[model samples]
Target: MKTKLFSALATMVAPTAMTVGSVSADAVAPQTSKADFSVVAKDPTNPTDPENGTLVLKSVPSFSFGTIEASEIYAGFTGKVAKTAGALEIADIRLGKSDWSLTADMAQFTDDANKLTGAILNLDSTGSLGETLTGAVKDDSPAVEVVKGNGKHGVDNFKMEAATLTLAANPAADLAKDESFTTTINWNLSSTTPTAPTA
Candidate 1:
């Protein structure tokens, strides 16, 4: 009976041991296997060549004032005109004082002087604000002066002070009969520079 029991135990153990050895052999085979790789030559030209093209940079600066007109007027009379009874007509008034303001476009250029020299300034027009008297003066008259303000620069930007307009008498206009005066105000960017304010 002991001999028969020993024989049955050996048969069961032998098959279980063989199954474990088969799994172990499969795992060891992966460790001994060799992996193959390859290397190729690099292309002579850059991959991003077409996308990395050349670029050109240009600087354009310009400035202009708002459409200005005679908003208010105050006239004074002298010697003989003071004794007149009735008020003077708007057309006939002489030696009158007028006040007007221009809604200035200050953000056209980073520098005032550069904007004036780079482009022409016109009144209420977009294309080359030319120095033309839109109201009652000729085109060639030198009746305007380009006034510049104190320049202030912050970071990468700069601004100029308010440009004041002065109207001088036209040389060709009639002095005696024609009491009307007209002039053009040009914001010249050619003379813009950073400076301290005057008291």
Candidate 2:
């Protein structure tokens, strides 16, 4: 009976070994492929009946006067025709002003520099009421003169006086169409030496 039992167990183990030996092995091929595409389009056209947009414009006119490039200070001396009181002052000055005309040129639009124009004058401590200062462009022969004094005084110890630039509509009117603009003026001052004052 023991030998029959041992024989049955050996038969069971043999079937298990045979099943393990029947395992299968295989190899898979790698996939290799590429994809391609292209794009084609056009911009949309504006509507024929377009709405008019509002344009608000603003600007400030300011100018700067440079220092006295050339100046002459004379003390009291005798040869002069008449005796002058205290010290005498002689000043020669030059100045400039620039109008920054900013325009929002949209959708094939343009604004020319000729549309905007102005003048600036140089002022000093000695600027008298109703004094007229002149300026000119380097290439242009036309010179612009600005008048001083509208009852305004200097702010501090500098003794600088207030002045105004009278701009015409024909020259600078077109710049008013933009949202904002600015005008900057610069000036120079100079003078020659004077004869010594006499006692």
Candidate 3:
């Protein structure tokens, strides 16, 4: 009996002694991973429309100078095209590469009668927008730089204030009754320094 009791006590105490030994739980971390990302600009809706969620250049409105009496001596007339601030807005949303600019064509005004040569439109460079129109440009010549865009996304907003077109008149030009004159002023937006568009 004494031997059996001792054996039972030993069996019970054996588990307690085994628990005194060190028992370890390991801690580990999984390997890291990465994900790639990219973006694409949306296409323009129409020739006259601005693109969605991307860079877009809108067509400029036609400028009209009311009828003026002709003179034998050289004369000059100036017409305001965009007087209100923020009238001209360029929308851009490119990521990382956000440099852009604008160019306007210097052109001669033409009458339907094929007369009035040497009449040119002049754009003033100094004005409210920190010399926005610095120099004059004409058609058939290199385009005039309009804007050195601020590198940004939607945060960048630009407009021209007090922009005008001056018409230089020559006396020898032939006259026409109710004569109409028209010229196309092309505007281009580029990611780099701009050149005039091809005729």
Candidate 4:
């Protein structure tokens, strides 16, 4: 009887088994991919891909002043402006105030024979989220910086309105009748390297 009572007491006092190994979880840095930039188009309908974290110059506007009459061609004569032809778009996948610069320059208007002498192109911006990108681009000089900085905090998609193009210079001579001329407006973008935030 005494032995049975001792056994029961020992069984009641037995210890429970336990596992003692360590368990852990880990995290890694985020990977960012960029989307290829599309050709500049007026009234761009391309969607921003924040998922790809694209920090790029998405598109720039292609303006049309339409056909001009030789008699009416003069300084400050901006021909019949096409509707919604000057919306420049940017794609940003960034942290904090991401700095960027957009520059523009123009080529001389050319006919089949020669350049249209003394003609200048001026871009007038009506809307901008940050810095206004309005400037004149002469064929003789380097591109002018139109806008600098996002004019906002953090990453975002932005639209810079380039409202109209004014013919700032008069041709030295009268344009030949029925002559059509073409020119190019070159655009460039600059991105500053970002620094990580610290506590």
Ranking, lDDT, top scorer first: 4, 3, 2, 1
lDDT of 2 at 6: 5
TM-score per prediction, in order, is 0.15, 0.21, 0.54, 0.57
Which is the leading candidate under TM-score? 4
* Residues 111-179, model 2: lDDT tens digits: 233322222122223333233332322111232322222332221111223422222223122221121
Candidate 1 deviant stretches above 4 angstroms: 1-60, 70-156, 171-199
- Native-structure RMSD, model 4: 28.3
Model 4 worst lDDT run, 10 consecutive residues: 5-14
User: How would the candidate models be sorted by TM-score, starting from the highest?
Assistant: 4, 3, 2, 1
- How many angstroms is residue 106 displaced in model 3 relative to the true structure, after the best TM-score fit? 3.3
Find the 10 residues in a row with the least total lDDT in model 1. 3-12
* Residue runs of model 4 more than 4 Å from their true location after superposition: 1-52, 74-82, 126-128, 151-162, 168-177, 194-199
- Report the C-alpha lDDT of model 1 over 1-199, residue by residue, as the tens digit: 0000000000000000000000001111110101111111111101111111111001111222222121111111111101111110001011122111111121111111111111112222111212211222113333332221122111111121121122222222112211222112221122211111223
How do the residues 33-124 of candidate 3 rate in per-residue lDDT, one tens digit apiece? 11111111111111333333445543232223322444411353455242322223444554455466666553444444433334333444
**Which ten-residue region of model 3 has the weakest summed lDDT?**
3-12
lDDT tens digits, residues 1-199, model 4?
A: 0000000000000011101111111111221111111111111023343333334454454333434444344333553343333245554455655576667555555545545444444556533455565676665468788766644533333333344444444445334444445554555555654322223
Model 3: runs farther than 4 Å from truth? 1-53, 72-74, 77-86, 115-134, 155-161, 192-199
lDDT of 3: 0.35
